[model samples]
Target: MSKKQWPSWGHGEQAQQHYLVEPRALAGGGDVRHVHAFLRACGWRDKTQRGGPLALQSPDRTVRIEYQPAGMPGGWTIQGAAAPGRDAWWAHLGAQTPVEIVAGFTDALTQPRAAHAPNVWAPLREQRWRRPPETEHVTATSPDGSAWVQYRPSAGGGAMWWSGAQDRQGNGWVAQFTPSTPLHLVEAFTAALASPEPVMRPLGHVPHSARLRTTSVSVLPSQLGAWQQARITAARAATWASTAPRNARPRSTAARHHAPTGGARARH
Candidate 1:
């Protein structure tokens, strides 16, 4: 995604600049490599962290994304197993989340876009979610109150995690996920990563700007047909979704995976 610097410090930042709005639905299934490629192709940098298993980038001032899996094995791990033989998991499911995601990161604009004037401009300005953080990570509580998770860039670029609040005050509340939650999120992302589609909005209706189909790109036929086929192959062993949902449920994807598959039969 295009570099999103902190809102420019100066005025008259209303410079006309071109930013890429990468179709988010195309990047999914723990396919960080592919997502990075897609963003770079569009002139965005894949700002992945050191050990994160997922890939993410700022395509433009319009948005930033945390390339994540739908279902990670452990759901969400508090303390990594390697950190002295400890393991704990939290089950986050069916929790309501706002549509526009808060993008608390910026910088790394090796390929700078032309800002029109002295006005400071940042990429990914398409969103309004705020509460910026001074650090690289941010913690958000699951609506169910069952879990308190951290949303931060991955180590090498794949997934994210945090220690439970109940476990620690502020110490273990944040960190990358380990083997603990990998499989759980893998399943969740595999299920959620799909083509763009219309969706129900907070107003009890579909917004004119909303895409009704699947949103994650990883689940799209253009990329993960075989991967999904394999997922179906191991469907029996797979469990339910993780806390932070990647996309809609199976019924949701089937309904919007393009050609009228599962769910209702009214073709779009």
Candidate 2:
């Protein structure tokens, strides 16, 4: 069988932008849901899975897209939607980089010429549905700077948190983050590591690494931003104090590793 090729994110190193219009809007009234459904019907899945704006990725793992709703008054900003191509278009409507994708209207730059109006949706429809590859690593530092967590992308389309800390019993703890963990969730987990509580609380669905003694916690992406004030509280209370002494606190990568019970090997 022939390999399938999808559109690239355009010529620039940065993601070029484009707008999506409602299919039937030019005629009169229109709705954006049809466009959303068409994309879903074409095999896109909501990466977040939460009820919010759409965050979609191509099955071939070539594109990551964020789309706006029809009601938002101002033009929308899609942070992660870029792909290689001079232009991406819908048969009835189209758009290009920096183009505005309104709910019911396609911009002039992307509209296809009448001669090239053959089955526009065919390419996407025929695309083999597949999950995006794990290609990113995200990390965030704690407020006190004593500890940090590294969030590695998972091949299963979510994210895992690999953290370093020490238990009350002084055993080094190397735990994994829950699936699809968000920033705040990881932050909360880190904060818990600093808590004065004797037993270090688990964060997310951490799993034990047979090679490196560890445990897991279940975390919810829904609770992402909920830890802002709580994190501040923990920081004020010096939650990470149990890990190291005042002057001997972990101030760098080597120190964080030292703070843990033993050297932990990272899993792929």
Maximum-lDDT candidate: 2
Tens-place lDDT digits, model 2, residues 14-53: 3211111111111111233333443443454557457654
TM-score of each: 0.21, 0.20
Candidate 1 lDDT tens digits, 24-94: 22111122232233345444555557766343443333233443333443112122122234344222211
Error of 2 at 249 (Å): 64
Alpha carbon lDDT of residue 77, candidate 2?
Answer: 27
lDDT value for model 2: 0.30
Q: What is the C-alpha RMSD of each candidate to the true structure, in Å?
A: 20.7, 26.3
